[model samples]
Target: MQILINLDANHPTFPPGTLDTRSRSLMETYIKERFFDNLMYHEAVQKDFAVWLEAHQKNSQASPKGKRLEIRKIRSAAEKGLNTTTLLGEMERLHFDARNNVPDKQINFGLSHLIDTDFLARMAKQAGNPDIPITQRRGLMLFGATLMVGIRTSEWTTARLISDNPPVLPGETAAHPILVIQTAKTRKVDPEPRYLILEGFDRGALGMIEACIEMTASMTNGHLGQLVAGMRQAMLRVADSPEAFELIEHIDMRTARKVFTVESRRDKCSPEAVSAALGHTTTNNLRWYAQGDIHCERLTDIPLARATLNAVKKVRDPLADFNERKQLAGGKPLSGYPDLGTDNPNADLDNRGSASLANRLINPQGNR
Candidate 1:
């Protein structure tokens, strides 16, 4: 004897072993819209659905990974039969095995791509051009601000820039500027706003925010969502152009966060400092955005590396000088020591060596 499985009997809101006509209709409509039309939750259609999924995979033109996700959703919704549990288990195993065969993908772009000098220069140039549309220019400014500030895309939509009576200027030499963001993701019990102080190395952040405000000042109430949509459209135009922007392939707000974290680290800023800048209370929350390779092999003049080398040289030079001075002050008299500058034939050689070491210790860079 064969047992039958009632597909709609498992509806959460309806009574057990009973199917509500309205809910069944709604489910049918959802399946048609999400997967395909004429799909029935019956054992007889299982083979047909499998065949349809294969055809859909080919015709949808979606990537293999995306197709896998769609298949999983379909399996979850359609699993209702005597063999449903076994079938679902087999499907999962197949997916896992198939994924194991594919090589692990490496991150093609990271902080360097986001902060590429060429890309930033182009954005800045476009934003300042008076000939460009006001909306597009404003979008450029928004994008620049997002990149510089490392705020979430959603946060950017609700952020505000407020200054003192005079209104802070926009330049590297400008006074301190602050950006206020009404954070969306926080503990429900105690919600508070966050502030980003734009100054010092990140002084350019203020310029971007100022430009955005200036462009939108004519409107009485300009919505940040609309402004960001305009910017996204502008970026899409660049991405579609023949001579696309260098880093325009997949640049988004998430990329902005990674760029900020990696650039901060490269600038010798501690993880704690970066976390605080990103409005996180601890470094644990920062790991996701700070996954870029720390030791980049690219040939570039890393400012932090140079500063570190200089610091090491400073310490070493002082220690060398101290050791030389101590030996000279406490060692035997010049006449009693043969290695010293005494009345010996090799006195000139010893004096020359001492002079060279002293010069090296004094001028670590070897400059005259």
Candidate 2:
């Protein structure tokens, strides 16, 4: 329910502050110790080279050239990624036994995982319901967007969202109003606008959650700053009230932004589109570590709640699809009196011979 950061049913019920600290530690340690150690498998296979070097360092007369040949042979053998896998396998055999026990909640989102449309649809379904918890609402809205849209966690910040109401525009249509936004990272000169449709939007569901955000914003009078802070508080609530939801993240805002980025790319948004949607002007500007982009699947991949309803009317109306059909096909004459037997259409042979008999019909040559 808390989106990326989930509660471990098996873990002890630590206080909010303690739970927060542990979550941060786990996210960090899991990456460095488990993930990186497994990821740099080739390097892990060569770690004994360091120990061998240390031994050589102790005895300078040791055949440095002989050691090089042995190293070359080992390197050749290592080219087989199976040897690399063996490093991970060895690590698993050694470290993954008792330590195999991990937290019940998974934090890391793999790139392949975002294709789960069911997962994203579930977020919308859960949030579409008004009775859902405020804490759950906070997490799903942002995380759902990240998962569905493919954004980087690092770009997520206090000032970027408005949990209460979307940013308003002048003379904008009531159906889909454009929201003005400034980039949180580049802080570009001119702010850009994004249009989001609220028609058929589950306002009953979203409005209830916004009420809490509005209450938090009212604590401050200034509109711009209060809007951002309100969003932050709501997200923190989404993470779970530090009092109720077990708030986490000790590293810094930068780390949290990274989390946003990772989850977003996981949602399968191409890097370019995601960058544009998030207010980044270019992909080159993002750090190499950031989830750059993902390819989109199809039109069905995006939300079309109201538009989909419009498609239903065609099923009942016979002429509902008339715009796409050719309506004038039947008006053609039967080919200008077809006696299509002649190779040259104007031969006049029938008139030359048959006029003798037909003359009786026209003039009654011998009788009338």
Candidate 3:
């Protein structure tokens, strides 16, 4: 409301503080008039939707996830003689900001390139291509497994694949395959391992995880980081476009973990269930990772509605220019100006550019 009032030309100017009662009243009246006008509001909707979408994108891009990822990279760099003090200070500030500030929570950030089914499928296809390097194929397998199970970067070495109980039990349809992951970032409070049921994924997804486990059987956790890096390069080789390449370039464990949580929530799983899958002992931390369905739907659908409405041109105010011209002429009528106020009601759309492009194109003669 305050933003709307500040944007209005006739709004009263005041110091940088709370709005006065008159300003608030004017803002309310403006909103009511805009809502009740009932005549097509395409122009206003387009303008407002553009502003809102830009702001949403900006906030999502500036999310704490980016900062945390950067902090981790810098800390890792410091091990090889990047300034340790500065890195530690930055980490501390990140923690402080997270606690004190309201970070931008993204909505409907599901099924993106970072964790899309098609992207995974393409990588899997590349894995099976004998022409591709065996090392690249191995990395792709590990990449798909990490994304599907949402394993932490550090947990790659500790993650173990355990088959369902009585692996070959006849007609055990309820039996679910398990992936055990040693929890990271527990700060020594909750270091217990978490189990993920692989029943949610299909046989193809299981193949990726199985292949990854077989390849890494002889390697230690310390070697897994380099393998993950190789996966990023493999992803680049398969990316079909520059935008896909950019998103794949920033692929990290956090992105995969977020995808897991969101996809789980999309399946109508309770918050507690999703939190447990994420290895969180409580649901308190879920807010940073995922939002409720209503918020996501509202934001994701706004642009869709805006695109459909944008085909029609803006509605012109016929009296606006005439009134301005009259005011300039000392509130007297111009000599040659025809009074548009007296024009026929049916002809109102004539000079107003109110006819939709589809209608105009279909009936060039303007009969219907």
Candidate 4:
């Protein structure tokens, strides 16, 4: 601003603090009305100034050389800063006194990079190259998915990867999927119980996890901080770019949970069932997942409604929130459980007619 002010009329800068209230007001008015009325505002301003100067001409004999400049520098600097549209604000309130402030009074922020689907697809294709090696390539997928999952950085300390698995055998027609999760976040899933049907391993998802376990087991740097440092080095070898973030940010647990939530909802599983499958303390953890951008095409085609009920029934009775154990136990509704449309519009009459309220498969006829 000071530099601009010091410049001559045809110079690079304006004269410092030389602008008075009248010129400043007119300059602001010029900026505000120029686009709407067509850019005749500068000519209009000069004409108005001539009229004003006519009245002053009789009272004073001052030269045009002494005239002070104000808004020129401030407006010029702001335009240079990419805040070109700031003048589009409420001009009635944003009046600035040029004699008091410098042109660079405000800071300018740059534009942010956008996440385009085309770019993501390109990155995914690059990730799919066979020469990249399975271990390194799988790491990128986990990292990308984890970044999308958006877990808070503070909780990374005690985060543990859980697996509910009988370690999917070499071949089996009836295998449950492997569930990977954080332990402190959920104690609902039994630590000792090993039960899950392994899902497909197209992206080397399971292999990467196995590799991580093996690496940590062999490395003497097993301490949390040391492990973090070691993983950073390993990530540099794989990512090879300045964009690779911290190793923990690449873990896929959160993404896997998001996948489950999307699939559960796409298949229209009840909140209770998703809660059990996710090992959540309540249905609240799903709130974040529900808000995510999950494509319907990516949803697993499992009958979540039925599978959910089966899973829910296996949970121990007399849970913290679940009562009416007798009704649900005998496949009947107690006082608490909603029985069909009699009380709640979304109640299950079919389930009530069947065996246990807790064991009910989705009552399709009911308002789910």
Candidate 5:
């Protein structure tokens, strides 16, 4: 799939002595037209599925088993593609490829859709209001939590508050709340569940989540999923005013997540810390969203930095002795603890043996 997207018709291959300018021209024209057609089809398919899903949802109760099956099939099929998996790397790389001068705007990563923390605080306050409709309350909570904790929309179906036995950090006397959620896109590998610790300002986030779960308790899983997914648009109807409404006009779940990612890094949080907060097993996603170090200070004088520099400088090129060592180890890399030998200054044991061993060798007073 990526190969098709990256095809370069300008460099066409041909057999020896085969001079065919017509074939070369034909290939170039075909590739140009093919990309255009694919782009159009992608756009059309998205619009078609959205319309179909809306219609199906309106007639959900009245829709027959066949219609329901079709709706599910269409939704699944629309989401299945290389684009989803390659979003963080391969697709992003295509934009920087010199061969294709793709404009930065053409690659929509949603990194610029930053939501104001003040606005999020306002939504959080609204989420606690009991006078509003339950749906509206849940919608606000959904939006707030996504921005606060970086919860993916799909994970909402399985998200729940697990405040029991909150782990207390060092020097902290009281335990804080925790939001337990299954990491999305990782159920296949049975990945460990992620627990988001809610402390200080974020302590109320768990309460709002609890409220959302309590109100939707009786709802079926399918209905719950639908309601949670709709919160992206439903949130606007619950907005406080024209300003709040306008703020979220172009925002979706992904955009909310992007705001969280960008804001976290902007606030000087470490990339590894942000990745952990986002429930990612690695910093790969963090790199894609934030890209590069947020803090640019070069601290080469620090102890660790000096130690690392010294260690790196001491490294000998393995290729220099490759030929001599290759046959000695049957072309396999040798593995063992290098510091255990006598050459190590830190090792307690030496070639002569330990002081205790020397003491025993003296046989206490004299040789018995």
Candidate 6:
């Protein structure tokens, strides 16, 4: 007589003891939805999945980074004993082959390359004029705000202006007007929303932003996306002019940030201060924006060589006292030329005639 051994039913690989009703239900449901008849969980499968993920290209359609994140989620679910084998198998089968070495798309625009303040002022003035279309005016207002803040287009669009507790008195200046940026790119490192202080020439930037918000409040339905887009278009039109075309070939959000970074350095702001203001965790990232040819037109006026020479003279005596030596050492002229003046009488006569003719031509009445 042969005894029937129920090896499948009493599998040692399964977790021991009865799971709670919810856990059991979840596990059963996951297994039923995902697993096939022949599939089974194995340590080797997990290893293979990890190796495949590492070898895969990171720039594929699903993005390797994104896929890795999803894998992490599956791993977490599996650790909870909810469809462990099935989820691991699915993750292993996923295609993660994408290019990982794609170069960064950041384009650094130095201060020299960006449009000057005169062009910006012209655009702002035209935008402020009542004769222009309201839509164009609104766009110019936003553009002025962008130029002033040097923020990303998305940030510019989403940013809100909150006045100080006590409104700035008329005919008086506000030291720092606040610009609240809702969505920042570096939220992972710096989670808090940025409240930027606007000072100097940028103080009016917030006013322009507020004015734009007010003007388009009805048309935008409280969404600044359309307003932002219109502003970008308007800026492009302004850039298209012959005078500004060379300086501002295109209006790029990244370029705006780059210009801001360079200008901040030019204004003597420390790297730490600039990085903090720009919502960056490290000054290393600021290098990309700050590493550009400095506008040294004013530096040329410094007389560095002359100043260095003067400094050296103060430290040491002259190599030779040429002034004193000049009295001691006299040199004789060359003996070959006896007379330096014009010797030919006919040549002198010719020169006098030419001179008299030139004088007569100048004063015809005197000539008579």
Task: Please give the lDDT score at residue 195 for candidate 4.
Answer: 24
Candidates 1 and 2 compared: the better one by TM-score is 1
| Root-mean-square deviation of candidate 6 | 31.0
lDDT of 3: 0.51
Q: Candidate 2 vs. truth: CA RMSD?
A: 26.4
Winner on lDDT (3 vs 4): 3
- Poorly placed runs, candidate 5 (over 4 Å): 1-114, 121-134, 168-175, 201-203, 215-247, 291-368
Count of residue pairs whose backbone atoms collide, per candidate: 0, 16, 0, 12, 0, 6
TM-score of model 6 (CA atoms): 0.40
Tens digit of per-residue lDDT, candidate 5, span 139-218: 55665556666767667667777577776644345666666677787646777566665654343555666765565556
Model 6 Cα shift for residue 289 (angstroms): 3.2
**Which regions of candidate 1 fall more than 4 Å away from where they truly are?**
1-111, 130-132, 157-176, 201-207, 211-247, 296-368
What TM-score, over all chains together, does every model reach? 0.41, 0.29, 0.49, 0.35, 0.41, 0.40
Question: What lDDT would each prediction earn against the true structure?
Answer: 0.51, 0.35, 0.51, 0.38, 0.47, 0.46
TM-score leaderboard ranking: 3, 5, 1, 6, 4, 2
Worst 10 residues of 3 by lDDT: 300-309
Q: Output the better candidate (5/6) by TM-score.
A: 5
User: After superposition on all CA atoms, how large is the RMSD of candidate 3?
Assistant: 24.6
Worst 10 residues of 1 by lDDT: 301-310
In model 2, what is the error at residue 36, expressed in angstroms? 32
- Candidate 1, 285: how far from true, in Å? 3.0
Candidate 4: which stretches are off by over 4 Å? 1-141, 144-173, 176-182, 186-190, 202-205, 215-256, 267-273, 293-310, 314-368
